[model samples]
Target: LIQTVKLRLFLLLLHWFHPYLLTTSSNSFPSFPLARERMKSQYVTNICLLILCLGAANNTPWPLLIFLASLLPLLHHTCRVPGGSAWRGVPAAPGPAGWPLLGCIPFMGPLAHRRLAELAASHGASRLMALTVGATRVVISSHPDTAREILCGSAFADRPPKEAARLLMFERAIGFSPSGEYWRHLRRVATGNLFCPRRIAAQEGLRQRVAGDMVRRVGYEMERKGSVELRGVLERGSLESMVGSLFGESSLGREREEELVGMVKEGYDLIGTFNWEDYFPMGGLLDFHGVGRRCKTLAEKVRSLVGEVIAERRRGGLHSHVGLGEDFLTALLTLPKEESLCDSDIVAVLWEMIFRGTDVVAILLEWIMARMALHPGVQAKAQQELSACLGGAQRAVRDSDIPKLPYLQAVVKEVLRLHPPGPLLSWARLAVRDVHVGKSLVPAGTTAMVNMWAITHDGSVWADPWAFRPERFLE
Candidate 1:
């Protein structure tokens, strides 16, 4: 009776202090699981106390002994058996030890990619190694061949569900969507209309105009202030090209362009920033990092802006074109009536193209410029090649000049080889079925990551892998 009274008092105390113990914001995600877990804990405690009372009332040790014995198997499984060992016939790849439920999240630092590469290298595994990050089982491919083996097939093409992909991107973005008819349709539409060779060639004038404007802007800034910032110019030019291709140059005013660029930058940073909610299912409820909240806000802003543009285009009956040629938005809008997409899907495609296309070009240009600044000899060689290709007539480099400028192209290739923008090529691919990736047995449901960084930096694969030697390609 005394023990029961004490238990009741404890429960009352817990209920009274619950609000004080767990503080949550009004806009926070639901925390019903928190209450559920607490209730479960209390119920277990009550059951244990009742069992003790029964034992004492009967004056028998047998009941208590039997109950303790019953728990042995459960305890043994939780302690002795690791999470991954449950899958029979699947070979366990070498990886770090993990605590129950938590997995290897505690060990992962800020530089997770670099840390993963280090772990993979240290294990001296054949080609692949597995690590449990939070609840997710991930396999990192340490070699190019292993990466190809895993990624080459459709079996590993499905993307794992990520909070950012859902909340920030609305799960409509082609990059995050699962492999299906819709994905295939999106890819087909993109490749056939937006990225075909003929369409790309037609955008040459648009690219030249953007580049020329950037050059003029840089000259004005330098002449006025004796200095110029490349980031603003590069980002603006790249943003214009992508936006013009999507909504056309006439569709966006200066204000809209700035707004789109700002939102795009925020979206990029938010997506790139890791959110714990993805790994920990219940982690979103707390959202201590505020990643989810920020993403939600950014997604709302982007959706609203993109929706307005689409609405305006529809209302105005604008046949928006790029460089006086057909545009991607026009193609999407002009799709057959039978092949109609909802407004949300169309916005997603447009947003994704704008987000991806702008960042890639701008970031690559920044990287190449940085490399040139660091290696003047290489820059001089590229400049000489450009002059030779242009015949020293003070003419801007053109699309036609790209093929003829071997040394210039070589430098770009070397940069790409050394510093691939997507170092983790095709990140977060999920295995749909059991597959063997270069002697490594990757079971279905395993999250596979092709560590391109590890592959590129492997000394065995490349001679003097650390050196930034662009001339290596020339040789």
Candidate 2:
């Protein structure tokens, strides 16, 4: 009995001092009851030693204690996988070295876009960039071929996560949702109703009306103030157009419009800020930095407004045609029951549609105007085209005339290429399975972001990528 006790204590000491013993050779240890019993005894011994160590080290500094605690799990992980194929090193692309635990979090400061741009320029667009943000490993591809491969392939169809989707869409709307049956249905309905050629043609009249109002508003401001704030005017005009189209009439007065605009702006600003919870996962519980709280408040406000609009539409009758030929809301409500449409679903879809439609149009208009202002030559060319097409008509540019104006179309395309509304088309992925892009193996649950901004700016893909000359598309 004394010999057995001694043997057990010796085994315990070995287990505590060198845990890698078992992992070194799977075949070394016999699969017998005696070996199993010895293992259990060793574990107990190790636990006792751990307790004793903690008691003895009670006077250790708090930071040291925390550091040791953090290292304990890592030590166990490395030891348990000794000589295991799982621990084999894989070839990875080069990236900046980061500190332990925090890993590149400090590098990605408030100006992530500017910082990333600088990194791309310095590192070269063909190189793969990796950054460990909290526990997540983010790999950035600056190659247009890689970006195109990821975006166009079926391997990357699932959206990232709820937190990311919420930030991008400003609501738990279906647009940024995971690629599922619900998302498919939502996309089908939206494409059929809002993005189809026929629907776009119908919406053309609305766009022309809004654009005319915008031009008039800009002229009035320029005449009164001698110069117009282009961004502000475009923002309001775009918001009005979206609200009018979605509701078939403007429910938002000046105050409401301003409020909605502010909310949308806040949404955009919040999305750009790095939320601790987004990277740290459990960090959300503490509501660290109060970002989660702010997001919840904004979401609630938007939801309430959307709920009100949906209620009004339902009460007014599903197919109410009070001019404007029954807007999007009317079409949604009028869909057959067999189509599985619900009031909440309609509100969600409309919420996503309004924000996306308004924001993209506003940004695109601003970019186009800025580009035109920067290049007087391009501006003159556009003005000449406008004159030739409309004969100096003081009205909005019509959609019917867009096809006839090749230069204008080229300008739009160039702007889209240079400054896509979404720099990264929200991350997408296919269901858990191995996917290959060239030699790289994209494992299951891998998040894929099509870095459209990086792709468009790649020197390899475009000659003199920094130049904003729209003539590149003229051919």
Candidate 3:
């Protein structure tokens, strides 16, 4: 009898609010007798539910639980505070009215990029589309202008990392670190130390060795197995190349190199896997795939390994910096007191370089190889350009030689256009403040993402976007 009375009261409130008071202000709606009963019923319902839950734990009948479960949507709507910003005023950028807790997560399958684009187009929000994934508001930029605005806007300058990234210590690194004094200092130090022309020239020998080693490995794989699987070879070589650049070539022993390669692969996998915690509140507790657990283990390993390296350099244990090309480690070690990073920060910065760089370099190269096979004519032209640049001489390619091969450069550019390594710009950018992306106002605390894949593939953006045309870039 009591349960039936509660059910009738719940239905009555739902019926009242169905059209009459959903949009009305508190001045009129709260004064209603049903509204007063709602407030009182809320507390009574909580106590009743708790007692019923304890009974259910003792194998209570399923009927009551089923009935209560059926009323969840009503409960969720009733519990929401009135006059939410998402509903009031101009209204949040129009999108789907997702389910109670899951939001639009259940709708966006594996092809979330395509799905988001479709959703945007369907809602006539082709430029900036808004949606929620597990109650987290996310605005996606589907057009080039909108994407550019979000990318360049100061309000969206903060690159809030996904849950996996944070658990894996990405927040401390340059790539995902919040915009601030530390990030600026970190960027300056890294750029000055590692990316300068002088440093590039200095690392020529390291690049040559890594390339030659990769070619030899490919040949060996072919000879032994009659074919080569380049994924493992490329992944390992790319990681080692990044490590060599950071720690000075050959600073890490062979065993350590292999260990670090394994760890980078772990990071790459974790970063690629979608974690529920990134979207949903309290989602961290649901580690169904052990993503968080693995990320923690990886973080500890990276810190320990990178810390070991920094310690060795400090103790003068490595093959001396005697002939070294002054890697990032050396520059960081010699940083002025004002710019000096803590040991943990140093490890994060170094690990981040390798972790982010390897997979991207490897993947880009893989796409180039695929494109080369698909377009033999383009490959032939690229080869001819290379041959001309080398002037019939047997030698390795140099950074300076790049200017002499415009066609080859175009080939690389076109490949990037067609197959960008980071389809969503690697990760989503966060709105530090309410920002207007085109005409849409992305509220503060919302996540913003650029759909680079959509932009790159759009018919309006490129003439025959599906066609692989290197010559278009050359023009």
Error of 1 at 400 (Å): 1.1
In model 3, the Cα lDDT at residue 280 comes to 67
Candidate order, lDDT descending: 3, 1, 2
Q: 225-289, model 2: which lDDT tens digit per residue? A: 99998888888888888877777756556776787888778877776667767666686775655
lDDT of 2 at 118: 50
Give the clash count for each candidate. Answer: 0, 2, 0
Please state the error at residue 198 of candidate 3 in Å. 2.0
User: Which 10-residue window of candidate 1 scores lowest in summed lDDT?
Assistant: 79-88
TM-score of 3: 0.81
TM-score-based ranking: 3, 1, 2
Candidate 2 Cα outliers beyond 4 Å, as residue runs: 1-91, 109-114, 117-127, 162-164, 167-172, 251-255, 322-324, 392-395, 425-432
True-structure RMSD, every candidate: 11.1, 11.8, 8.9
Model 3: per-residue lDDT, tens digit, 1-475? 9678656755664554354223433465443222432343344345445645675577666566545543654554543422122323434665654444655665555566766666666666668766667757777787889888888889987876587888777468887788898888888988888888888888888888999899999999999999888888888889878888898877899999889888878887887786788876778888788999999888998888889889989999434563448777887887789788889889888888888888889888888899999999999999998998899898889878988999988988898988877777364799999877766777778888888877888888899998999999866
Model 3 regions lying over 4 Å from their true place: 1-90, 107-110, 317-324, 425-427
Using lDDT as the measure, name the better of candidate 2 and candidate 3: 3
For candidate 2, the 10 contiguous residues with the lowest summed lDDT are 79-88
